[model samples]
Target chain A: MDTKAYIASGILELYVAGQLSEKENLEVAEYAETYPEIKKEISEIEAAVLALSEAAAPNKPLSFEAVKNRVELSEDTKLIPLNRGRNRWLPYVGWAASAALLAGLGYFYNQNNQLRSDIKLAETEIQALEEQIAGASDSLEKTTALLQTLRDKNVTVIPLGGQVAAPEAYAKAYWNETEKQLFIDAQGLPEPPDGMDYQVWSLTLNPLTPTSVGLLENFQTDENGVFALSNPNQSQAFGITLEPAGGSESPNLEQLYVLGTVSS
Target chain B: MQLEELVERFKQKDLRAFEQLYAMYARNICGAINTIVRDEVLAEEICQDVFVKVWEKSDAYNSSKGRFFTWVLNIARNAAIDELRSKSHKNQKLNLSADYFVGILERADDEPNGNVNTDRIIGFIKNLKQKCIELIDLIYFKGYSQKEVSESLDIPLGTVKTRNRNCISQLREHMKQN
Candidate 1:
């Protein structure tokens, strides 16, 4: 009945160390739940042990990525039993042959249906393969086009570093002065909040006049986080701001994420 | 405890939850393994494998059985022991010295920046008795049962529990003073 005596008995330490039997552990767990002080004492014991063991660690903890990959791989291995289950069907055919002649015809008919289903499965698998090949080609073409745009000599590369709101935010403006087109690499930018899109701007210094280039629409669907927009302004600098989905008529100076001056 | 919630999430195969638990206990688990295997590289490898096994066998864990740290600590010890008994370790004939956790701190003057918190553990170990270190190492680090500890330390069966109590009280006191 005395909590102090219970705490001093040191059973709680053994309980935390898992030295107690199942019955003893359950009793301790019950007592801990019944008495808050018991629970606190248990935690303190655990904390002390944890500190001692942690100090013996030889190196920093390994990242969880390795653990995750191995665990997921084992998870995937479970699905493989489905195919192994199919192989058992072949052994059944041999047994059916020895069982009786009358059963042979029925077994053949069943095997015919199984073969038909297998053919259907193979056809669907081929369709999946075709779709994958088509998807890969589509991405390859897009990558080639993106590379061409990046390599174009006329394009001016403006590095827009992160702003105060999002310190990690980054974007690049690849402007083609002759074509009046700008490609904005907003890879470093986080996704705009719902109903918000990042809008680009062309700024002229001295008077500090700002002109809207274009809004980066369908930001989510745009792969590679690169958007191409028309910019037809003689500007000394470029800036990007977050605006409503439809975009604002002017750049919101307060939301300006990245800004860079055009160096002649 | 909030850790119970994290353990529940871990049982549900939440990787983020698993990561949170790992960060909390990895050092302790790895340290325990290192204490047994006495090989930093091998202990690290086994420590990682223990976590992966824990993830695969998460269904085997819950509060009713024991503390999550206790469960993990057992796994780490068993894994490190297995490594010690394996052929490679046998050929090496590792002496498997009786160096307890405090020994790491005692030897820290030689390697000041060893992965361990030399300053903090030194402060803790400075006032700790040799008996306290040995008892904690046996029951806590080595995963020895009370009966085993009693036999190994030649202490009376009745005294093991209370003796460990006093020893841990000293540790808690040291922690408080620091």
Candidate 2:
């Protein structure tokens, strides 16, 4: 490419006038990009033309803002303040200070949140431990009162051996005559089947009469494995049987788990 | 090429970049329109609309097409010509013989300090031949294509670019001196 010859061709003038086709315009742009001298020539030509056009403009032409207002293509942005810094690097220094301040504020904000969450976690753990302690002390107090009742001298203890239904089961009955309360210690008893309860019976010797004692309700939840029932019928002997949820009309003798005699 | 960068950003709808471009070309575009329309107020009106149209049609412009000024100049010329075709412009023609824009500088001499742009611009064309003035007005201000200029001026088709080049060179020489 003879750059001087291309510059002398005057094709660049028409290019500035936009008289060329698309292909010619692209070719001119390519040459301008590649050749500095050609680009300079084009700029000079453009300046001369620009001057003529500017002279022909209205004496009181509208301001740039006025022309800008006629369009809504994101031209409504607020004017950014131009830098009024004294030194060349003042803006860079200001920006650095701002960024550092923002980072410091962010760090402290995160630290404050972390401390607050730690304090909350400690408070929650303390509350849960306090509830557990209250529950344990309440259970211990109930078990201690039951232990004291077992030692009362007016209460007679009867050992009941497992019947044919469960030969391995055993229990003790503490019969308090004054209180009419019979405490059954059923540590050796197997859990009752689903939808069933353990019913106690007070028996008479000759006629084999059976009187109802209260069922062991909530047998599954008794952690101490001991139950008490009211027995006022002068029970001669005692038997434990697995009956349906409500006590039966008579003991299902086939399911009797324990039998004991009340010693004189 | 900061101007190139600005034009690229302007095409991407960057309002700030477009502001720079509007400042750069708005006056020249209005002046060009005034030459065609020969009414300062009406030319300013058309010039405002032309920039808005330029923004709306920015996608139609890119570095690949031609000079950004040329694109804008083409738009202003069309808009000004369109206004002239309207019935209202028929009555507003200041001089039916005003075939060139140098008359603008002559008209500006009557104004006070507002004559600064035309004053300096008048110096550039002070030594220009009448043919130079007509060619400049037709090619740069009127956006006449090479073929259109040749046919209108009755010149051979091949001579338009060289003749335009001579006229613009004289403009550059005057611009350098002033």
Candidate 3:
């Protein structure tokens, strides 16, 4: 394109004047972009026009803020969100902080209520244990009275000695002939290990046979160290052995902790 | 850095950009309205109105259409013309002679701070033929197209562009001198 001819064509002057049609205006805009000379010429023309128009302005200067207010009013009518940072207000700041604090308080209150319920649950568990201790002490007194009855003059006391399996273990049996009850004191034996408990048996010496009695269910936890057994058989001797928890039908001879004969 | 970039920011509702653009063209816009209205108070009012209108209708401006100043110029001229044609102005004593910009230049001679000297402008304006003034007044100030200017000035169809070029060149020389 002949840049000089385009410049001399005077379209740039009208371009500055804004008198050109849309198509012509776009063409001029393209030329202005492609050629610096065209752009310079357009600027010069615009500068000249600007000076002329400005000289024609009234002597009095108008307020820029008054015009800005009108702009703001129109913006409000259009519901455009204004930049609040440029114009600050105290109420907006206060309201924002209040909302944040409200949300934080609501979260803290919920956590507080949960902690209160947990504390209540722990208090209830402590009260229930106190009742169980009181019941255990009451049962110990009744057991002591039964022990006193067996130690009478008609009772037979058998001294059981520890056998080869456990020489340190010993036991004693108090037999009551009339009542047909036997109380075994196995305090000389150690507590059975986990998954196993001590079983007692009554023996008849003539047949050399042993009969199952009962297992000491609370051998480890029982404080008194005495076990009550029913002796209905005509037994001349009694033996105590460590059997399985449910008790065996016959005494475990290898596991026999003690043996004694009842003197008639 | 570019004027279009500045105007685009203004369209996006950038206040700093708007203020810069206002500072750049506010005087020219006010001057243009004052030339037609001839009332300083009314000119200030219309100038502010024109700026408000510019901001409100910022989306309507496209660089391909014209310069930013030209777009603002069109707004100021239209607003001034509308005020002139309104019922309030129509009933008043229309002081037609004092309304032209040349009258302001003539009256400024008596004031101490009148930077625009009438003799200098008239001398520079003399370089432009009588036809140049009529074409400039119609096309630039009145927002008339070549066809309209040609019909108004009784000029031939082909001469409007060349004549306007000559008139603008004279004004450009006058601006360079001051």
Compute each candidate's TM-score over C-alphas: 0.56, 0.54, 0.54
Candidate 3 stretches greater than 4 Å from native: A80-264, B91-100, B112-123
lDDT of 2 by residue, B65-155 (tens): 7899988988888888887877476776533234788887777755644666568778778789988788777887777777777777788
Candidate 3: C-alpha lDDT: 0.79
What lDDT does candidate 3 reach at residue A8?
80
> TM-scores for chain A, candidates in order?
0.59, 0.57, 0.47
lDDT of 3 at B109: 44
**Candidate 2 docking classification:** medium
lDDT of 3 by residue, B1-178 (tens): 6788899999898877998899888988887788788777898988998999899888899876688898899889889988998848887664433234655654644453545543455456555676776677677777778887778778886888888888898888775776
Clash pairs, model 3 backbone: A57-B31
Best by DockQ: 2
Candidate 2 on A1-264: residue-level lDDT in tens? 999888878899988888888899999999999999999999999888888878877666457777566565334332322333335578898999999999999999999999999999999999999998987887787788888888888999999999899999999998998899899988889989999989999999888999889898888888888888888988889999999998799999999999999999
Best by TM-score: 1
Better of 1 and 2 by TM-score: 1
lDDT of 1: 0.84
**lDDT tens readout by residue for model 1, B1-178:** 3987899999998888999998888878988887887667887889889999999889998666788888888888888878888747688664443667676655554566654454676678668898888898888878788888888889898999999999999999999987
Weakest 10 consecutive residues of candidate 3 chain B by summed lDDT = B94-103
lDDT of 1 by residue, A73-186 (tens): 778678676766778687897677677776877889999999999999999999999999999889889989888977899889999987776678888999998888899998
